[model samples]
Target: MTSKKSPVGGHIPVAGGMATKGLKYAAEIGAEAVQVFVSNPRGWAQAAGKPAEDAAMRESGVPTFVHAPYLVNFGSPTPETLERSVASVRHSLQRGAAIGALGVVVHTGSAVTQPFDDAMRQVREHVLPLLDELPNDAPDILLEPMAGQGAMLCATVDQLGPFFEHLENHPKLGVCLDTCHAFCAGHDLAAPDGVQKTLDLLVETVGPGRLKLVHANDSKDPCGSFKDRHENIGAGQIGEKPFAELFRHPEVAGVPFIIETPGRSADPHRKDVETLKRLRDNA
Candidate 1:
């Protein structure tokens, strides 16, 4: 197995291509890790992965992760949506395994108009079965809590425990804490010692080992705004202070951070990576 190096990186766009060129783009931007989509993030179609490309990725030594489709919402009221969500997760895991990815990230979707209890039950009934079916060699399934927008299932970090309880706390399950989402969901990551307090809560709730990934984004909206917009590092409501605190936190030392900030091209991403590295070194 390729060992993890530095934990800081960003989500490289698949503008060049998937797998092959994606890996090259990540390296060019100084990413020590990367997150990519195995298929259309907005669609349900499953694309066949290339074995040669997968092998190259494994040998490239960059820690990789696959983000499942955006349309996947196990808490959806529609039966078709729930069914497709499960299938998309399954396919994403398979692709992750093929590419030797460390983990597969999926949003802990919204409950919509459904009663919250009913939504949890839907996750238990529909989502747990899929989790049980994951291959032993498959990458860990990392659940990313969403912004508390319209009945979001795992809006707050505390809610992660209940979600895990529904999944029976499967060994392969993990958490991907998105800083921007957490702040928007009212985690108060901007306060004094805020990042440490947030990490403490995560460690207490999910155990330190399961805190596998961090989405290092700054929020476009203010705290508790329920907006999911992301801005470049140090450029949003979440300034550089919180990020420096995040890097200094002992629990997050080796955890991979993938920035989901916005930019027209690679230049912005490169700068973000450099900024994060500087923070870590200085911290």
Candidate 2:
């Protein structure tokens, strides 16, 4: 059964209601796991979850994830931005807990015109408290590495080393690797042995069990392009083959693969989910 296996799903839109819109869309796409944004993805607004919607999500019995607002930049050089980022993350963790989420995915934001060392210093100061403050059963703060664009804090698997070190490798901190990001960061997941090599490095860098989620998407740009555009599975630069390798990789055995591929229509997401399921089952 898919429940006992690594589930494949997509980032379901939660605009109307978590259950009525988000969960309903998930079912239509045959998603075994789901990810949703609890607030405006591109805004700093911190919105609370509706009790009924939260309860409905909990009762759905599907693995769930919460994506923190896209504008959350913990490494921002500005004081106001940093303060709001910290508050936003705390809010996301609370919302994730309310909905029985497996993790809260936050972008490993940029240094943004600051020295890398100084930026990481800010990250430690702002992020450590939140990690330390999680309840025992609270969802992990999963760091989704960026596409190596601009001044990303953690893009390549190796770069995660310093990020984890600064946070002292807190137990509550986990990783959410995005294929497009890794490819853009030059992991070469499209190569014959690229997926395996990248997974190997990730396991080595973070140690086992820290990779909690995977964003399964193809890239619109070629490897090392530093672009974040996502394409449908097998329909772009990172071909279908690497995903098969990913499915068989021991490091990701039980991790959920959530697609952030292009298209809001259920049809595209369903096809992507079904394609991943085939690769997963065959592997």
Candidate 3:
């Protein structure tokens, strides 16, 4: 793929029940990229996609990313949940390919009641087979590290190495860094050099090449609070200054920074996108 500076965008709802509408909404808000759910985020059911809509999205020239269902938990203790999680990922990748998505983001899920070792074993046993099944042209499966809530698998940036090791460092595996989650998990993005330190840590741990997508949201809670609530850019605990640092980080250049903040309407998201673009341009 031809690379430029980093792309700034947001997660917009499918306007009027059409994926094309969502793409249009993203453009209306001056987004350079976009993220969308191919199916119900909270459900296991994968929706059938239309080729026309996929073609339209591809024709729109906006870089796209697909977020896998929230129900996916590859580390689940139950066999059925594990099976469904694998299936969901496969389905999401298939849809992502159809829409020419750069990556498909899935949460690095919790181990729940199981021991962390057992969860890693489950991830190896179940997730490896699914990875093996992917086509050569399939989009990268971007593992998003979660806030340090409950028994989350990749609770911090440093913990991602183990997850990649469990998968044998597959090329199809990558990372999606969420600013709010990173702060909530104790990376402290509000500090002057915090965004740089976090990006440097990520580059140190995963390498700059493996860093694929970014969820650029401010945190509603304090640093190390472990809450996952996402506030709009510049309006929460993360403030606005650090995002300039994020924009200036050399490692983050060409990565897609997607905002998953509050407000369902286009107006709020438009402002957020503008804010990020301004930061990026002036950085």
Candidate 4:
């Protein structure tokens, strides 16, 4: 059982269908942390959180985090879409606070026809005010970079530097580094020294303090493939060795690693969680 203890409390299921059962399922498996979506991931509708369930989860002593809806694209070409995205982000931030979540994760979407500088400007203009309005206890807004595919932005860790600069060190702004996405963005984390180099670059570019969470999904594609396929922990293109390095990295010792891997019917929660735990313990 001691060997089963997860480093950052392991991976969590972000499905809303398992919302009520999420805490109980997580507690039974000895998870020290968890992440959930406040509503349907494929839609924009925000679901009302249950106080009783939230309290139960809090009492379980498991740290919780909320993931924003998947439909939110801050870089939408349409003004209406951008407006809705802003509203949805603000709502998720507020909802995350209500449920005692540490933070809410949102994808760093593309700017479409707009220049990257304009995208950064829009984020600063529309998102910074929301962060400023958050109370001290409000959950932080974590930006997750996507694979370097299409117009989708935030492909690299260094690319996010100017965007963070525009926010001017907002307390509520942080990062959620996804392993698969990082690999897809051209940062090699598979070789013996790969994970260390990538981690060093991350700490240098984003500051370790701003790294609030991680999505520990192994990719189904090769390095710099620009694909978003996520396989089970060790059964992917990125083998399991690099994760040992990731788990032992002091900068990310206590950050939550949410499983954004595929699968709904036959959820691989236990396997993935145990895989991370084993890596941490072995290290």
Candidate 5:
């Protein structure tokens, strides 16, 4: 296994504070990367990012990414919801640029009885062109695949190929593979061989260049369960061995592993990050 030199990266629920304090906290935690919500996750109200604060974060040399609001669903059957999702994505990209973030993460959504093909088409027709207009500095749109439980299009790594085909493989499009979702969608990431095989298939389908981010979460549910429950590192069904395999994978060698696991108190975040760092170092 290939051992890593710099295993320290990002962690989640960045905590409520002044924008600069968020950066300070990440630095204090020894994180070289960070993720933040540009707006309230549960709301449609978009918060404006301060230019000075954004510049401060950018100058910190930490690779940053924005997690889009949870309520914005591009695949919503309703026209209002669809419009909002596109607008939300556009706003997110703008916000990301303000903070010099590399990308913005948005969930691959369900079509709610509407054909997924049609929803993908909406993404292409209504969303892709806006991306086309943006400059190179515009943060890439990182689509996160959900567990295969509903009308979601990119349910698993295997199912995500059609999205590239549908989008004609837009340059700005990339992926954020969530380990918990991948496990729930039937990829056995807990096993060393299974993690390698799953990542190999992912690289084959999306190409390593487009695999930009990872939500390094462990799942509470069994593989192929299609449930979205997450657990702390080494405390879930996934254990620690597969994460060693994951951190060792050349495809994700320098990628940021953001923790979306449960953060009841400081200890869980501390434990999860420490466990991941150890796994990466011992890989």
Candidate 6:
């Protein structure tokens, strides 16, 4: 979030190079803020990035975010999984700062085989230190609540309270609210005034300035479906009106909207970015 209106963008690809290929894609889609994975989304690898990539992104002057691998689950009951999760998170934080990411997004994972309390204890033990040791220049760690599926530790914005408590509300800790996940978690964003209510609750839950980013996506399933499928804006169950309302929300005044919508090339991402820009400008 900043002093100006939110910038809309997409999760651009970093195939040949981050700044070269990724920013090219970002330019193609007219992104104002961007999101990218530092490693394989479904794997445990955490690769180092090039300094040129970091310098290029920083010089580009666009707000950016890093989405951690999907396998990061500190709430896991298994020893190896928890270890890898912590390492992966640490690497992400390092790489994010290197690449000038404004925030690093990691999912609020599940309890798996353990009890909820035990899993949260594990989270506190493994994650609190990382938050505590974050460099002054490093990006904030954004905890992304998942869809209300399985033993997810945090889904609804209300659930974020416990996480904040465990981490003692670290200043660098933030939240990335995914539209499709919220819809599936039963926020009812498709209903009239639903977007307002959800955002109001988010501010209430996390307090002001903690909502750093928004994953601007639509859901393929109905509200309360608990599915994570993402669709294009206005082309799914959440519809487009809610996004217009999102633009009008006072709490997310300077936040960036990054579309994680369906797309193979830049066409769909460009459309989603333009659509959000229209809604935001019109709002």
TM-score of each: 0.95, 0.98, 0.96, 0.91, 0.93, 0.98
Angstrom error of the Cα, residue 103, model 4: value is 0.7
| Model 6 global lDDT (CA atoms, 0 to 1) | 0.92
What would the per-residue lDDT of candidate 5 be over residues 1-283, giving only the tens digit for each residue?
Answer: 4433433555444445425578666655566678888877887777777767877877877788899988767677799888888777788888888888888998888888788778878767776786687788889988899988877777789777877777778888889989999999989887658988988998899887787888888889999999999998888888888887887788887778888778755566767778888888778
Q: How does candidate 1 score on lDDT?
A: 0.85
Off by over 4 Å in 3: 1-3, 15-17
Please write out the lDDT profile of model 6 over residues 69-157, one tens digit for every residue.
99999999899999999999899898888888899999999998789999899989999999999977899999999999999999999
Name every residue pair that clashes in candidate 4.
Answer: none
How well is each residue in 174-281 modelled by candidate 3, as lDDT tens digits? 999999999999998888789878989888888768989989999889999999999999999999998888877777778899999899678889999999888888
Q: Which residue runs of candidate 4 sit more than 4 Å off their true CA positions?
A: 1-19, 28-30, 265-267
User: Each candidate: what lDDT?
Assistant: 0.85, 0.91, 0.87, 0.77, 0.79, 0.92
Could you tell me which 10 consecutive residues in candidate 2 have the lowest summed lDDT? 1-10
Candidate 1, residue 129: Cα displacement in angstroms equals 2.4
TM-score of 4: 0.91
Worst 10 residues of 1 by lDDT: 1-10
Q: Rank the candidates by lDDT, best first.
A: 6, 2, 3, 1, 5, 4
Q: What does candidate 4's lDDT look like per residue over 1-283, in tens digits?
A: 2223343544345344334577656755556678877777788777776777666655665677888888888667678878888878888887777667888889988888988777777878788888899998889989889889988778788877776888887878899889999988898889878887877877788786788888889999999999999888888988888888887777777667776666553347667777787777787
Tens digits of lDDT, candidate 1, 180-239 = 999999988989967878889888888767888999999989999988999999999988
**Cα lDDT for residue 94, model 4?**
72
